[model samples]
Target: MFERFTKPARAAVVQSQVEARRLGHDRIDDSHLLLGVLAQEAGVGARVLTELGVGLDAARDAVAALHAPDAQALGALGIDLDEVRRKAEAAFGEGALERRFARRRGFFRRSTGHIAFTRPAKAALEDALRQALTLRHNYIGTEHLVLGLLTGGSSTAGRVLHRLGVRVDAAELRRRVLDELGRAA
Candidate 1:
């Protein structure tokens, strides 16, 4: 499948790993893949998403927000995360919040220095190939990757796209993709 990927597609996959590592994620998820795709400013996928008002910065913010603690929700109730953390640390000693939120170091920890792909991410890549085949394209490009991310319903990337008001339904995304392809051609 990788052998058929165009240069931009390969770059996006590689960039996903870099983004995952930079974000302190042990594994690359759909959000990381989307970030990778958006990083390619000249890629067809990036251009299409940009046209939809979902540029790199917007996508990055969405992914970062997903990782962020639900502080805003608490803030709505007049609770301050920082204030609660300060109180907890004062009573329980330093690093109280870190200890509380930290998971046990085991399976979730990276066994190797290399970041691994999450199941949904792998599925998206495979789906990219399927997308290319479905379109009767010889090469798997970034556009196919975008399609995969949109159609891979269980993925974080798909959820983000949906949240961003991009149509993620199969028919709608396909139509938009074909329109983009027609324009590019």
Candidate 2:
């Protein structure tokens, strides 16, 4: 199945792992895959998303927000993250989060090298293959990947894409991606 991936599709897969690591996530979710597609600027996936007003940075920010440390729930308890960070930084001299992680590494530690793909992410990849076969495409491209994400409507990536104002739910995103692919060809 991987052998059928085009250059850009392959890049997106690799980028997804990189994105997961960069975001401090031990697992790669569908959102990471979408971020990877967005990172591949020359890919039709990125172009289609951009045309729909979804930029890579904005997507990254959205994914990060989802992983944020329950700020809203904590705020309900009158615990302000910003204020906590500020106070911690003032006492610790700066980069308090970094220092905390460094301290944890000295004692509590595990293999941080491997990032497993969450079930939804794996399903998206499988769906990409199905999409390619359904479309009678010999090779799976970034467009197929976007279709896969769209098909997995419950995935974090799908939700983020929709929230970012893409027309994935309405089924127009596939058309936009195909249009971009056509123009690219």
RMSD list, candidates in order: 4.2, 3.6
lDDT (Cα, tens digit) per residue for candidate 1, span 8-78? 98999999988776665667898999999999988888887887778777787788778767998999999
TM-score of each prediction: 0.77, 0.81
- Give the alpha carbon lDDT tens digit for every residue of 52-102 in model 2: 899999999999988779988999999999999999899977875543231
Best by TM-score: 2
lDDT of 1: 0.82
Q: State the displacement of the C-alpha of residue 2, model 1, in Å, after optimal TM-score superposition.
A: 1.1
Cα-based lDDT at residue 103, candidate 1: 32
User: Which stretches of candidate 1 lie above 4 Å from their native place?
Assistant: 72-112
In candidate 2, the residue pairs with backbone N, CA or C atoms under 3 Å apart (3 or more residues apart, or in different chains) clash, namely none
In terms of lDDT, model 2 sits at: 0.83
Single out the weakest 10-residue window by summed lDDT for candidate 1. Answer: 100-109
Residue 84 in model 1: lDDT: 94
